[model samples]
Target chain A: MNNKITQNLYLLPYALWIVLFVIAPLLLVLYYSFFDIEGHFSLMNYMNFFTPVYMKMAFSSFWYAFLITFISLIFAYPTAYLLTKTRHKQLWLLLIIVPSWINLLLKAYAFLGIFGTKGIANSFLEAIGVGSKQILFTDFSFIFVSVYIFIPFMILPIFNSLNEMNPSLLDAANDLGASKWTTFRRVIFPLTINGVKSGCQVVFIPALSLFMLTRLIAGNRVITLGTAIEQHFLVTRDWGMGSTIAVFLIIIMFLIMSVTGNRKRGV
Target chain B: MSKLVRFFFAIILVSAVLFYTVHELNNSEGYSGRNTLTIYNWGDYIDPQLIKRFEKETGVKVIYETFDSNEAMLTKIEQGGTTYDIAIPSEYMIDKMRKERLLIPLDHSKLPNLHYIDKRFMDLPFDEDNKYSVPYFWGTVGIVYNSKMLGGKKITSWNDLWDSDLRNKILLIDGAREVMGMGLNSLGYSLNDTNHNHLHQAKRKLDLLTPNIKAIVGDESRLLLENEEASIGLVWSGVASEIMSENKNLEYAVPKEGSNLWFDNMVIPKTAKNIKAAHKFINFMLDPKIAAKNAEYVNYSTPNKHALSYMPKGTVNDERFYPSPELTRKLEVYENLGKKNLAYYNELFLEFKMHRK
Candidate 1:
């Protein structure tokens, strides 16, 4: 009981901070979602959320996030596997992690240098007589930047999971006459599923709310729920509507996580 | 553990917490001294040298803050959190702030350099008699195009954005007000129109144009022009000038339908602590030499007649910088739409954004 009291005291600061900053703000968002500027309680904000335009935007945001998660999973799994098997594992990990230190906006800006009309890609294509002009500021650029920014998130988790896997289990499977493919399917895949899910959670949530990169790379051609929320709060000065959209986003995220969690638990 | 090691660890942790506490306390106090003045303005909107000059002249330390949009600035100010002495807001926003009792009216006697302003821009709708705000810079919203890509066609009006040939080849401002205002102006409606039918019609036209938009952009016209990511875009004159400076192929022109003529003004908010220092700083910036130098650096048109006289003859004569009086007559100033109208406009903008097509 004394040790338990000491541990609670140690946890107090962090618990308070979480409650104050995260939970309090989330509750405020929920409350504001139901109230208008005049402090009248109404469902107008939520009903407005159901509009076809916002519905489309919400769908697109989820769809793009899912696509990015799937792509990152495909790319990161092999990369993590290769790094684990490599001799210079630390050096390879350092290389992958290095770009993560750079500001996300700077990374998006750098994409402009490589993909802009006068950028290297276009110049090279023009020189080789392959293509005519730039590829920057399109939907492709948006996806490309999103994938690049999020790949690190995907890789680190999977890498840690792979590193934690017991080599003895693989050896035992081999001894049982399990082929390489069969062993990977039965042992490796099942074991790494949690890491993959957590990685998706990390990448999907952030990618869904990515406003700056979308604004920069997509040239605002693609509008997401995140951008709409920003516009409402910052530009329109309609906090009621902005908070409503944010609440909707949180609910959708909750639903997605719960469903995914249940599926992972096989319940 | 050794007593010495435990003592060292406790010292390190205590000192770290102490340092963080001091930092937070300092930040919370903000500009406290009588010698300090905080100015909040748009990003990259002013010449840094002008602020330095003001500080040097008045012996007041100037802390500069920036926001990308008027609404963002208003939101920050409305929270009653940040104590800013001077803020630069657009004309309509100035009116809004005045209505909200957020602004402190200026004493013209304190601002001796107010005489430098041209007679034409005075007594404007937003702040008639120049009570609450002083005009800093003025410009028109217009289209910037690459002449090389338009097939030698002069992209004269907002209608050019909808030309079938330009499909998937144009860009527009990401700002709802600017774009929707342009659409309204193109349809012979007021830029500040709040009529639901007018807004819907403008939105429908924008719907047709959305698919053609290569990207919507704000404030990155320099990159867009240099990279050729867009052939034409709706941009402010200051940005247009920057684009033209970087790329010779780039050109800016006001649409034949007339475009938004906006003026960013300097004002003192009610929460200002150092009103005297703020007034002195404003007068310092209004000095003709200082104003002209700022205009030259920022590439925006100054509202000061004396500043114009001090500028190079060619710059003053440049049509892009100083449009013909006839062209000036065609430009319409945006007015602050009342609350109900603002809500209606916001709804339309939100609906359009939600609708993918």
Candidate 2:
């Protein structure tokens, strides 16, 4: 009882801060979502969220985020496997982490310098007597930058899972006359599924909301739910609409988290 | 622990808290009193020397913060946390703020130097009789092109953006209102039209032009000019001026159809704690010499008639800076659309973005 009391006392400040900052603000957003700017309670803002344009923007955001997650996993898995196989793991880890320490905005800007119309890629192509200019501000740049920015998130978790794998299981599969590829597929891949799932979750959530990169690098040619929320709050000054969209986003995130959590519990 | 040491620790803790609280209180009070004023404005939109002169003349310290967009400034004020004594918002946004009752009416008598302003800029639709806003700078949205890259072909209309010859070699402003308004204006409709069918037609035109566009850039027309990324672009006059200054090959021209004329104005918000200081600062900036110095420093056109005389002889005569009366007559100022129309316009903007291949 005394220990519990001490623990509660220790958590008091954190609980108060969270309630004041996070929970209170979210509750205010929820309240605003139900009303218009007139202060009277109304459902116009929520009704507006169901418009076809908002639906399209939300779907596009999800689709792009899904694609970025899947692509990052595909590229990350092999790299993580290689890192585990390397003898000098610390040096390889350093190489990966060092670039991540560079600011995300700087990295996005770096890609701009390399992929712009007169950038290195185009100059190289020009030197080879090929095409003189290149396409840089299309959907392709959006996906490329998102995948590059989020590869580290995918790799770290998969790397941890791979590193934790017991060699004995693979040796056992080999002893049982299974082929190397089959053993790896059956034993190794199944064990790392949790890590892959977690990594994908991390990558998806951020990519869904990380529209600033899209705006700056993709030149605001693409619109996402994140951009819509920003425009509603900042540009339109419609906090009611902005809050409604934010609430909808939170609901979608909650659904994703609960479904994933239930699957993990069942496993 | 010894009683003496415990007492010392308590004193230290109490003093630290007191110091922090005092610092915050001081910051709040300093801006509220006659000692200082706070101004929020658009980035690179004003002359820093003007701020310095205001500070020196009035003995009121100025704390200035810059935002890149009018929407951003409005959102900050709407949150009702920070106390900004003065702000500069575009004409349309000023209308929106006035409807929201977010602005405090100007005391023109307090601003005696208002005589320096051209009468045409005053009593405009956004704030008639200049009740709330003071016009700071005015310019137009138009097409800027490289003569060398265009193969000596004279570009005249918005249709030039859709030309097949410039495929994958054109640029447009990233702003939805600006780009969509251009399409609407080219279609012989008002730039601020919120009609659904008109918007759809504008979207169709933009969709057709998207393939030819290399970038939809904001505040980076110089990058496009230096890199030769696009042969032509829909850009602001301020950006066009900067590009022309750097590269002599560039030329700015208003479209034959028509274009947007915008004016950013200074206003005091109702939430301001230092109204007197804000008014004094506005009057100080209105001084013709100060206005001229500001206009020369920041490359934007000033509304002060007296300031125009003080500008460099070439700048005063420059056609781009001061368009001919005929050209000026063709321009239209953007007006605030009603709520329903704003929704429709935003919806159409979304459709254009999503339906693009």
The candidates score, on chain A by TM-score, as follows 0.92, 0.92
lDDT at residue B347 of model 1 (Cα atoms): 62
Model 1 misplaced regions, further than 4 Å: A1-8, A37-39, A126-129, A262-267, B1-34, B324-326, B350-357
Enumerate residue pairs that collide in model 1: A53-B354, A53-B355
Best by TM-score: 1
TM-score of each: 0.92, 0.87
Candidate 2 lDDT tens digits, A80-144: 99999999986897788687898987887777778877788888988999986555777888898
How much lDDT does each candidate structure score? 0.83, 0.82
* Fnat for each model: 0.63, 0.53
For residues B1-357, write the lDDT of model 2, one tens digit per residue. 699999999999999999988678656644334577889987786778777767667767788898878778887898899989999999998999999999999998899999999887889989988899999998999988998988877778888777788877777775778888988988999898877788889989888887777766666646766567677888888878877787887888888899999999999997798899999988988999889988887787888999999989888788887786678888888888865566566656656666654
- Candidate 1, residue A217: CA error in Å? 0.8
lDDT for each residue of candidate 1 in B1-357, tens digit (9 for 90 to 100)? 699999999999999999988667545654234578889989988899887777666667788899988889988999987979999999999999999999999989999999998887787888989999888999999988998877677788888778888876776776778878987988888888888898999988877776667776767766776557778878898888877888888888898888898899999998788899989988988999989999998888999899988898987887876886677888888888865577677666656654443
Candidate 2 accuracy as TM-score: 0.87
Docking quality category of candidate 2 according to DockQ thresholds: acceptable
Q: Which stretches of candidate 2 lie over 4 Å from their true place?
A: A1-4, A7-27, A36-52, A128-130, A167-178, A262-267, B1-34, B49-59, B109-112
